[model samples]
Target: MIRVQARTEQSRLMTFASPLLAIVLTLIFGSILFTALGKDPLQALHVLLIMPLSDAYNVSEMLVKMGPLLLCAVGLSLCYRANLWNIGAEGQLLAGALGGSAVALAFGDSESMWVLPVTLLGGIASGMAWSAIPTYLKLKFNSNLILTTIMLNYIALYLLIWAVHGPLRDPMGFGFPESALFSDAALLPVLSDSGRVHLGVVFAVLAALVAWFILSKSHLGFKIRVYGADEPAATYAGFNANGISWFVMLFAGALAGLAGVAEVAGPIGQLTPNVSPGYGYSAIIVAYLGRLHPAGAIVSAVFLAILYMGGDLAQIEMGIPIAVVGMFQGVLLFFLLACDFFIRYRLVSSRETVA
Candidate 1:
């Protein structure tokens, strides 16, 4: 018989190696999936992985996608480090977009430089406000946050749908479910003259830096680590768990909301029913794949961004289903979890004596 036993001490080496192993496994499984779909695996792999890095324009687009993922993932890392499960980043993002859009629409005629800053603030506030619901419930009623957050995501989506179709609908869009284009002052400045990359990329990098600082150097960060490691120990140390929850949830919501505003004001240029293609959800995978570390999440976000670009490339150039991208993400996460499990436990042979 084979038995699984917990390690006496966790493997520090595996902590770094697991993500790489997960990537390799994901690639192997992805190749098999391509072959099963009746495609040349090597060619498909080239399209999905290699081709995205072949050109400058593609690289820029990948960076553009990376911005939101990085922001959301870094925020989520903070929450996870504090043992706070915040699953409604998607809803918070939508709420932020709506709030920012409302500002843009109201100040559509403004030429002031402050418009942009104010819009971003509106987004952050809205996101924090949305996340506050779950936090409040958990604090006041001892409700489960996971269920509330997930349910809030659907509610936010529906609200976005309604907004685009009714109140925020563009009059000149031929009846499309979209808002008007933001004013020039409301839009984010492009990073380069040729590419769609915007200032949001810089924001994402700054966010990662801030997250690293907080997690590594701050007293509050020390408390969060202690709280996550052992709740009772944290309580005995006189740490306020509820305060930590509020801080993390609100902070995470702010970052996610900023990502939402960036999408509308940078790339999309307007609010729409399809403001996001599951960036918030994908960021969850990014956070874990990066070991819930801020710096690691930056790299993971870039990798996931490549997958997103590759998905579109495969669809257009190789006739592969776009769903394959999502499949790859799911497979990568599955492998990551498996790797983590093995890192914490080992399989050993059990000797049985005849009874």
Candidate 2:
């Protein structure tokens, strides 16, 4: 029989090794999934991992997809570190798009270059405002944030659907459910000629660096770490858990919102019903896969971005469903969590008993 041996102190070696193990496991299963689909596993793996890196154009596209992922992951790291489960990033992202589009459509043509900044701010504020509801409920009524945040995402999605279909829909768009295209000044400038890589990458990178600094170096970061490690100890040390909760949710929501705006203003350049293909949700995986570290999140974000690109590639090359991509992501998360078992406990084998 296999038994788990709990360690006195969590093994730091296993802590880091787990992600590596997870990747290996994911690859093993992914190959199986591809083969089960009647596709060449090696070719699928090559397209999923290698093809993206081979072309400069694809590289730029990967960076474009990575931008919002990094942004959302950075914010999520804060909330995770503080032990605050704010899972409404998807809804928060939509709220940001709605708010930013409202601003951009209203004043995109104005002579003031301030429209872009104001739009960005509006998006961030919208995301924060949406997040605050659950935060307040959790703090005051002791509500389950997990349930509230998830329900809020659906609400946000319906709200966006309503706006695009009813109020915010472009009048001259031939009845399409989308806002008008943004002005040149309202759009984020492209970083290169080959693809849609834009200034959002810079923002995402900066957000990661800032998150790293705060979580690793600052006093508030220390408080958050303490609170995550031990709430009683944090309270004993004079840290207000409620305050930290609010800050973490707001900050995370803001970053997620900013990512939404970046997606619209940089690549899409307009509000649509489908502003994201679950970027916010995938970011949850990014946070854990990165082990809740900003630097690690960056790496994971890029890796996930490749998965996104690979999904498209697979669809084109192998007639694979897009769900295959999501399956890959799910497999990564599942294996990563399974690998986490080795961090604090080791497996041992003993005699098997017949039932």
C-alpha TM-scores of all predictions:
0.95, 0.96
In candidate 1, position 162 carries an lDDT of: 94
Give the poorly placed runs of model 2, Cα more than 4 Å off. Answer: 1-3, 348-355
Error of 1 at 145 (Å): 0.5
Candidate 1 per-residue C-alpha lDDT over 1-355 given as tens digits, one digit per residue, 9 for 90 to 100: 8788788988888888999999999999988888898999999888888887888888888889999999889989999998888888889988888888888878877999999999988888988998999999998999998999999989988998998898888888899999989999999999876669999899999999998898899998888889998999999999999988998899889999999888898899899888888888999999999899999999999999999999999999989989888888999999999999878887776762222
lDDT to native, each model: 0.90, 0.89
Candidate 2's displacement at residue 93, Å, is 0.8
Error of 2 at 203 (Å): 0.6
Per-residue lDDT of model 2, residues 1-355, tens digit only: 6766777889899888998899889999989988987889999999888887788899999998899888889888889988888788898988888888888888847757787888899888988988999999999999999999999999999999999998889898999999889988788879898989999899899999999998999998899899998999999989988888888899998998898888888899999999989988999999999999999999999999999998887788778888988888888999999999888887666542222
